[model samples]
Target: MSASDDYKRLQLALEAAGLDLWENDLVAGKVTHPATRTFQELGYTLEEVGDSLAFWMEILHPDDLPGVGAALEAYRDGRADNYRSEFRLRSKDGQWVWYANYGKVMSGTADVGMHRFIGVTFNIDDRKQREEELTRINQLLSAQNQQLDQMNGHLEKLSTTDPLTQLCNRRAINERLHRLVSTGQPPSALLFIDLDNFKKINDLYGHDVGDILLCQVAQRLQSCVDAGDLVARFGGDEFVLVIRETGNSASPFRTRIEYLCARILSILAQPYLVGDLMLSTYGSIGVVCFPDDGWTVDELTKRADIALYRAKHKGRNRYCFFQPNMETELQYQNNIETELRTALKTRQLELLYQIQVDRNLRPVGAEALLRWHHPVRGLLSPLAFLPDAIAGGLIHDIDELVLDTACATLGKWQQDPLLRDLTLAVNITARSFEHPAFADTVMRMLEKYRLPAGKLCLELTEHLKAQSFPDAAHIIDQLRAHGVRFALDDFGTGYSSLEALKHLKFDQIKLDAAFVADITDNTTSQAIATGVIAIASAMQIEILAECVERHEQLEHLMRRGVDRYQGYLFGKPLPQSAMEAAMHSTLGAQMA
Candidate 1:
């Protein structure tokens, strides 16, 4: 076929395939239109095209107008030859639609020099619209994911924070402090703050008012800090401030922090506005600089802690900077800690039994209290080594030792004709409840000693109930299934709400010594103890009052109807040999 016939056939084919081809004479600056139905499909009509190229240019979307004009100009000035560009065109309905309109020089002769431009306009508006929609949808999804991630992060923060005070909790603060020091950051400071006699307010008025007072204290603490400084809730009635960027001149920062501490104390000195109840409170603070105080977070906290001890020692409502002598004391504490670890390894620990008496002053069972009869120090109470052991991560070792000893001691006693009926009670730490091997460990101890599971009673302190319930409940279920009973020790001390008490399946509630000590003189204590007794009776859980020192205290506690009384009044804690002798005498007396 001839070239013109071939072109004609191709145009016919293009028309059949739903495409339109057209030409413009750049030299003449005139435009020509080729008939096609695709323009109608895109909301455009043939009657809309004007006779000049200027007419089509007028319909370009404003944003696309400049570039299209530039391209055409480039072609006309011979700066560009072939042209392919995308521009939005106003459809017949007057709405702008993007189009891919490309062209090539077709009719231009070399002699006439490239004046004719031919091109096809394809309706790609649907594809472009779908692509734009997809882009927009992707952006929206990305933003939603980012927001979700941020919300999750906020939830995590909330989990580790005290909601009312908006401060990091003891757990969070300790973790962050450990991380900061472990990272080997050179400069930092730890300031410990404790609200003085906060309980007196709670006792005089109510916890609601006390809560309001604490919130005010938190606000004051926040106000005292600069941006980016961290203030955390070290625990009940205590808070901590970590100064990360104190600019190397820690003294000035320390002074400012001390001033803040003084300000906090002063704020509490004023009457607290609690629902028309005017109340006054006080606070104590201790400050310690990093490296100067100690290298590790624990060391720094320990230094600040000793300073806090001194503040409380000198009297409440004061502030104390850690001094050289304080470091000396810390060194002594360190030496004690080292000695404690060695003592644990050498099995120098011992258990003392404190007799438990019923309302009739009859001895029933004895509590297994841990005592460290140090090689050189003679005898030391659990308080002496327990805290240091917990701090040094040796609590598990100590607890295991206590558990094994108690089991062995009780197991031997169970074989005795006289002491066989005695129940052995052991306290469970928070770590012990969360320990994955707790049930297994108890079972193994029981098996090793050939003791009945029912004879072994595990005492979990009130603080364990304050932890998350799912795991605590699971531990309870597992241990209870092994015929082991549970006791809530120090029952009135922590999170003592009915909600907390009801969640744990405690077989008994050990009244804290504080309540027992006050039972004789304090009416409030009497009422509280009565209420506790009533609750235990209703729950069918036994009640045991601790620290029954005086005969009057024992009489009052018995009258209040406590199931058992434990204290010096019965007998001070005795060594194993003493306990065995006392047991034999009691058996002989009972037989008589």
Candidate 2:
């Protein structure tokens, strides 16, 4: 075949493969392309064939120009055997298209520096676009995976930590205990701590302040522990500490544990400054040693809990070690709780009325005191089963029974003119009073008994005075609007302040028996009593002296401007029959 026919066939083949062929003559400073028509179709023109490098540089993307120029120069200088570069060039239609260029020196002498190059320029826009898309998708997936990993880590942390105090939670602590027991390398002691009167703090300051106090408590606990020990919040106002001993001796280990417990108690007992209020609280700690108390987490936790209960029962704000006998006492207490639950259903519960008299010894009111006549055990006072009732979540039931019985008695008393004017004072538990429906329930009971609101007085302990129940003032106001009166019972014996008394409206304040017990001789007691009376008088609240058994005590209280009195000096608590008989006799008239 002739040379013209072979060149035509080669041009047709290159066109069919979507390749544009070009040749550059370096010494001549000229460039030539075989497919002029193809170049026009791709939005380019080679009208100025000479100075091709300058023309290509003009068409190239500014960011890609330097890289392409460097690649060409290296190949020309024999530093690179072949030239290959990918670059963006602006097409005639104002769009940037990716192109891959391949070239080699067809004729060159390295020393003389004469060179002619031939290469193929291929349109790689589609492949390059796909590569860019894939890169973007990979980056996005990587970011999403990282975010998911972060979220999972946060969830794991949340599961193991107490959100309020940021301390290890119960589950985390239990798991740590299991791990430690499995290793069995070191002797460890577990201390169970329960804050004393924590509920009272929650009630008086509300949960917001309560949460702040809990965080402070957690910080104090952490400060008391060593680097190897762990402090975990075991829920509510309870915390558990895991202390590992370095030595093998049991005696020194126990001594160290006791020291830690004492230190913790001292630190936690210090007052906490929550917002504007300075509050005081204490902790009861129960200690148990591994191998000595139990081998497993459940057993040790149970024993520690029992010891904690014992600490609380033994005047609180103290620490106790686990003793085998405590389990028996715990079981007995549990049995008492079981029996107390049935006391009301079996009609074993009764109310004894304690008479309250005015300054003239006139009967003005009576306090309904609860009594339990156990089937096996004889009659028991509130102190005997009240704690059990509270722990068993049955105090509300007892409180309701007292309210119902008192209202029923008042309903019958309405028939007698002498007793009609006599007010009935019923003691209310803090839990019952804090119930959302307490006010409504009390009003309903009064209506059911046809008892006028003025005929009833709700006696609340001084503990309730410190609680920050948002609706407390509202509830009190609502009841007072219906003529119901309230009195602060056991007045000088609780954590109450003048600020609380100002906000909590009370019709009267009762002097606790302790304050009145030796008022005549004890100047401090007399002064306290005097101060209370003066405060009550200034607040327009009546003062009632309780446990006034001696004439000197009575005279002292009378001299201090006490409005009413209740104690054994006048009469002890009486049964329903005795109370009715006394009311019908001259004794009731004299008391009235």
Cα lDDT listed for each candidate: 0.75, 0.82
Per-residue C-alpha lDDT of model 1 across residues 68-146, encoded as one tens digit per residue: 7676666666666545456787767788776655566777552354567787765546545798754653465467552
Instruction: In angstroms, give how far residue 570 of model 1 lies from its true place.
Output: 2.6
TM-score of 1: 0.49
lDDT for each residue of candidate 2 in 483-527, tens digit (9 for 90 to 100): 889988888887664655878899989899998998989998988
TM-score of each: 0.49, 0.60
Off by more than 4 A, model 1 = 1-330, 360-362
In terms of TM-score, the best-performing candidate is 2
TM accuracy, model 2? 0.60
